[model samples]
Target chain A: MSIDVLLQQIVNGLVVGSVYALVALGYTMVYGILQLINFAHGEIVMIGALAALFVTNALIAVGVPPALALVIAILAAMIICAIVGVSVERIAYRPLRTAPRLAPLITAIGVSIFLQQIAILVFGRNYFTFPEIIPKTPMQFGAVIVTPNEIVIFVTSLLLMAGLLFLVNKTKIGTAMRATAEDQKVAGLMGIDINKIIAFTFAIGSGLGAVAGVMVASNYGQAHYFMGFMLGLKAFTAAVMGGIGNLWGAMVGGLILGLVENVGLMFVRGDYKDIFAFVVLVLVLIFRPQGLIGEKVAERA
Target chain B: MSALLENKRNQIIAFVALGIFLLILPFLAGMIGQAWVRILNITLLYVMLALGLNVVVGVAGLLDLGYVAFYAVGAYTWALLASNHFDLSYPFWVLLPLGAFLAALAGLMLGAPVLKLRGDYLAIVTLGFGEIIRILMNNLDKVSLPGSDTVYNLTNGPRGVTGIDGLNFFGFKVRQGIEVFGHQVTGLQLYYFVFLAIAILSVWMVYNLQHSRLGRAWQALREDEIAAKAMGINVRNVKLAAFAFGALTGGLAGGLFAAMQGFVSPESFGLLESVMILAMVVLGGMGHIPGVILGAVLLAAMPEVIRYVADENVQQKVFGLVVIAPEVLRNLIFSLAMILIMLYRPRGLWPSPDRKADTGGSAK
Candidate 1:
């Protein structure tokens, strides 16, 4: 009801929105290149979180400093998830490239369930809380209180987004990615290794998902086996909302979805926050199926 | 004998066999205890739900992740009308069709706008629509209904609707209560009612639709939308019809479910339920009626059966030592089954002959 409370909610929304943006990038980028909805992308985020947790736990067991252990965990998660992203493309999706669109989609769903089950099998189903490596202290600026974790989440996500944009527009690998996304056959004919480019795209996307997972775990202070399912759906909605094949659109869309959902919770209940995001998605599809920035890929439909 | 005569004979034999199986199933369940009978009833209800979903995803080639929304509509409709809510007492016959009609209306409303969106976009949009309905149901009390001073206490929010009256016909009750060999039974009667409804409707609709003009149009659309459109098929209308028809069946099933359980809750129709139903359709050959039913029954029964097997703590502990715990093992087995099916029989267990060439578009 108060201005301060509203502002605080907005801040919280933005932080959560940043993570959504990061995960949305994975979806948008993969969809851009392959026109496949990587349903397993959220699971990649989950794997990343677990990877970080395990790595941090291991580092701490070896007497490493808490902050250093956290850093090690992030890097390890990113690298591991990158490998997972690439392998998923190689093994599960490549054979279905020429197959019907539904084949890959089903396969993706299978991979998602497989990964989640594996996670459950490996790690106990109980919600796993990370050691508080980051300080929980809030900075009070005349009634606008922001936690250190929120600042880290927002900054890290923005930096990743900016880095991705730069890589896509300013580098050779990025050019290859864009070319492949435009037309895979033509890109292959033009001396670009389409397979390698796709693998690279997955690696980048999965790495981003990994970073998002870590950020979310750190911010929420807990991670669970099925944590990524709803988040994955919401992030995918964000991707579609921003225009499926466009990267920056995914970022903007994620932030908008997060802001709208958190703000709408003021009028409704917190449990219905997901519904707000979904409603926005439906409205966007009905009115502007091309999404917020419009379709970048001509044959996106 | 003529080919036509032989074909008709084969069909007759198949129908007779199916009828005999259904007739004997309750007797077998009676032998196994009423709980198993109830499980079979729920499984049949799921079969109906999966069959309805098949109309959308398997037939019309629209991936509807929110198909459960229509089910929710049907259940709530029955809940509101049959319960003491609004002091209204509708007869079973009246409420059943009314529920189906309202669910069909919801289908049309949702289908109209997003009919143009294809594939994953359509899927996610539908998913959102499902969520919106759920939220509305949850928040109905907050918003007052038009022309009513009493806030639309229709849903009863999270507490859900309970103590709903069962089906009754002129001086007779279909679910008068369950009955054993010589004793009166309450739950078994509801189970038999639901099971019979599911068996009759699933077989009738699936068979009729597969041989109808509408069925061909659905298959054509599934094969190639552009080609189907070029051939003078109104893609929009056909798609909408698929959605509406599917929602109608879902409504009937939902009503049956509500009547059987005597309760309805928003939680019963969540995204997970949607995914499970979709999985059933996919696991069974999409568009293959029998396959979908099999998929539904297997998926519905697997968890319960696993729980039954792992009921003892010592057995669970021993199983945990040998393999995974029952819960994790159950999910692993299901997921593995899906993966194996995708790899070995990507077309599903009994894929439609027309759909054999179109292997890539399984979900659609």
Candidate 2:
């Protein structure tokens, strides 16, 4: 392919990769702590995106400035999604905490389907148009072109990722998160309030997921009830690719996954784009099941 | 009481009674009409798929999220070989075992590379494998010739292959709709009987499998792989056997489905179908035959059952226009049911017989 097309694909990949990175962070954080895949994390992103769409449209209808409306919508979506993440943890997942390892996994899939059904009921199974708040002006750099939305999405994702890194690395709660992850029983014995830390994990993870949701919705110009399934799946792949339990690995995995998915289309038909993620997934899993960044643990029996 | 219930004599009696009931199931469904017989056929197909998955997830402790890909493989093989897609014109009986063997081969191929992975890693890989098959199917409809311009439809893309030939049994064709007992026995009814036979055979085979030496090896691996290996079980071979057997069962059902419906499509073998089959095994209680059967029937038929009960005609206009659409409630209720069942009855609605064997097969 031409360098211009390749450069454009890279730009597009990074923009989309940032959103995937955000979603993968939720998966990475939760898996690191609970060793659960958190299948419902994808739905949180959908809920946030839809909720933001609803609030922003409503605000605009009420004559609020478009810029202010978008900001409030994002905030509202994060709060609402965080609450949802906690509730799902409490109601569906908590009961099966001590059950078989697969119990929570099944529960997560059930909740993912249940939340999708709920979204279909509330949102009427149609795509809601998310108006473009950012300008559509194309910025040219001598054969490499970009849009305002792309730049905004890339910058916004970086800021959010940076914020998450700070919260997980420098904060006291971050220490609790790390401690509880290493061994839950010991952390609880040390009076770490494991419940709060777990809940906090869900909250932050879901909030970050919401930001990704809004970014994707804005990028695509619309969002639907089932947008989370494929995206969530890819993000999970990214999380695994980068190393499931490692934070920084998630970011790298998402970018790599995104780049490969888009860039691979240059050689093959575009219709086979979805298959590339799975192909990469199986290859990575076979060669480096722990992912690129995962520290080696004793091989599972 | 324990002695009588556990006696071989009583078991024979129960088996006979079940056989007699299944023989009459079609006639009973006929009273409701042909539409219901069709649903019963589909439900039976699900039972076959679920049973195959039971051998893997239930008996062997491998969570396979892509089991339906085998079903797809079987269906497509039958359609391409027997349908208008290629006009090869093979009979249903000829294609049944062949399709199943092909699916088993696919299973072996998949299990060989990835069987070493455990738990979630295995799950993600299996899931990817499933999507890979589906996407490949979806994209193979248009294949451009190497270095040439002609594009041929291999899978027919999303349009799917059609006009699959129906089953013909010993000079009696199900599609011809034979007359029996002064009533027209439609093709659907014939399908019900044939599929019922296949279901019974699959059950018998799987039941035998669960009690055989290989089955014991599978169970040993399930309980503790390292320990099983220490006890001299070939872990890889046994796991691969479980996968192949599961695929074989799924493929048999898929080939039969192609003959019964006279059509084949990619949509039938989706991730949701895989999950629903897994749900049957999980909800019915893993490693238990009777429990798995219960799960297969309930989950497969739950939506239609809900639809039948909640149709607008049945409503008494109770809530002053707060009417709940059946489709919406069906999905919501199904999901809630999954969550609630796992929450309350993690052992499944009907647990296996072995767990109760300690107390003369009595409830613990």
Best by TM-score: 2
For residues A104-148, write the lDDT of model 2, one tens digit per residue. 677788899989988987877898999989876889977878899
The lowest-lDDT stretch of 10 consecutive residues in candidate 2 chain A is A292-301
What TM-score do all the candidates reach, one by one?
Answer: 0.90, 0.95
lDDT of 1 by residue, A1-301 (tens): 8888788778878988999999999999999888899989999999999889988988999999999999989999999999988988887888777665655676777788888988988776889988888888989977788888789889989998999999999999999999999888889999999999999999999999999999989888989889889889889999889888899889998999888888888876686777778877888777887788956333233
Q: Any runs in candidate 1 off by more than 4 Å, and if so which?
A: A1-9, A296-301, B1-15, B84-88, B141-152, B176-190, B226-230, B306-323, B356-364
lDDT of 2 by residue, B1-364 (tens): 5687699999889879988998888778888987888899999999999999999988888888888999999998898898778768887668999999999999998898887677667777788888888888888888988899998888887788899888877667787788878988778888888888889888999999999999999988877777889999999999999999999998899899888888877888888888889889888888888889999999989988887876666654654453667677777788888889889976778877565321001111
Check candidate 2 and list the clashing pairs: none
- Supply the global lDDT for candidate 2: 0.86
